[model samples]
Target: MDTTTWTLEQVKDRISKGQEIDERVVDIGQNTVVKFADNVSAEEGEATMFIARMTSVPVARIYAILRDESDGVTYIVQEKLRGEPLINHLPTLDTATRDALALELQKILNELATLDKGHMGLFGRPSQYGSGILAKFDPPVPPIESPEDFLRWLPHNVRDNYGRDEAPLPTGIFDFSRPPIFSHGDFVPENILIEDGHVTGIIDWAYAGWYPYFWNDYIARRRSTLMAFQDGKWSQMVGQMMQPFPEEFRAFQQLYYRADSLL
Candidate 1:
């Protein structure tokens, strides 16, 4: 299970040779799992591990981070978590269990909010990853100082090209200001683990970082829409758990659509 000196090619070769692969980790036929940080930057690995260690949320324990000196890729070996993702069981849960899950998630969200860095913009380094293709503009999205700054930075041409003409940007939508808070950038059912009606862990911290207060709600709403389209009951259940921010959610939806259209 020792991959302290493995390279990206070496890891891939091992996997191709039938090494056990589970999500981000590659089981090297031993009692350990090797989580490869491929396509993710070193900073992301560092940030994820940092947040995992600091937060009370149940996350995989990091054993070590091995870097390939030649290409500078990072491989994170960590403990494999048990339990199925929340998405798999959401459909079977009754109302009471679902409510309990929601309350637990709310507590986790509140805790995450307390870990804010007091800054704005998407979390993580811009250099480590491109603005998600779904929202990249010409000048590129920068660290947001305020909601006004975020809206102002949207390229006019990009907006004109993909924006919904009927639903204009809400009046004074960006005028309001709220302090930045830590956002689990991609908080969806798939990232949450549950066993016997209790959440065991919340995984995936690649997008964990400080963002505007409304970002987490916005993301949950967006994911809820996708879930609704797939399963109405599940959608309604999740909506109840993670409330909605209608006005801001719609605003962000439009903004993301326009920005993402460019890609």
Candidate 2:
């Protein structure tokens, strides 16, 4: 039997079995080739997609499909690119295209800033802390019990960087804690798509959640923290660019960190 080709009858049977196949060839935007023959859904890269759906961000589009389907639930999809990925195409882009891409991304972030709170749904499934609130923020910390101990146990990083001495608090000692916004918790370039000079898609929502907006930056720095960005990994570069977002997005990322109680 040819795995690459399937009859519609075979596909219908497979789908009726609570699954789908690579029954048809689907070329998205421009470059992505999707094959659904055996009742399977869209498969991208080495991952198989199922139960995928698409939504729109203010400036970016979202696509998510289940990456795995063992739970009787498939992963989500929010990405579809028309042209080649930045990694495959970056070296060839003219400065104008590069700048245009960056500026367009910035505009998208700006639109995200004004989003309705309901947009937080973009995060998909929540692990705890009620989705965007982040369970980490509410994690139990051993009591300092006394001012002296409180001074002693303060995280060196927080003390050195976030201390009030260098800068006045943005609000109450906790006022920096703003409400969560819709965040592409796992912001990265692979999850983003650019066609011509404009961003066409924001894919991958498995890690989507209401995080302190700063998470985009934090996720971008995964290389430094996880040692995953060695040897010019494209993922690392994508995460790095996530840092230059405007201040409002910076604020959003900050909340994401706080969601992890890192702040």
Best by lDDT: 1
TM-score of 1: 0.77
Looking at candidate 1, the ten consecutive residues that score lowest on lDDT are 126-135
| Model 2 segments more than 4 A misplaced | 1-81, 118-175, 223-263
Candidate 2 lDDT over 1-263, as tens digits, reads 23335334443343354322133433332222333323332323112121122224422222333333443423222233454445445556676776667666655555555554432322332322222333223343343222222222334324454442221222222323355554555555555677776776655444554444444555555423444334444443443345433453444345334433645
lDDT of each: 0.64, 0.41
User: In angstroms, how far off is 212's CA in candidate 1?
Assistant: 2.2
Winner by TM-score:
1
Question: After best superposition, candidate 1 residue 12: deviation in angstroms?
Answer: 7.1
How far does residue 27 in candidate 1 sit from its true spot (Å)?
Answer: 3.1
Each candidate structure's count of clashing pairs: 1, 45
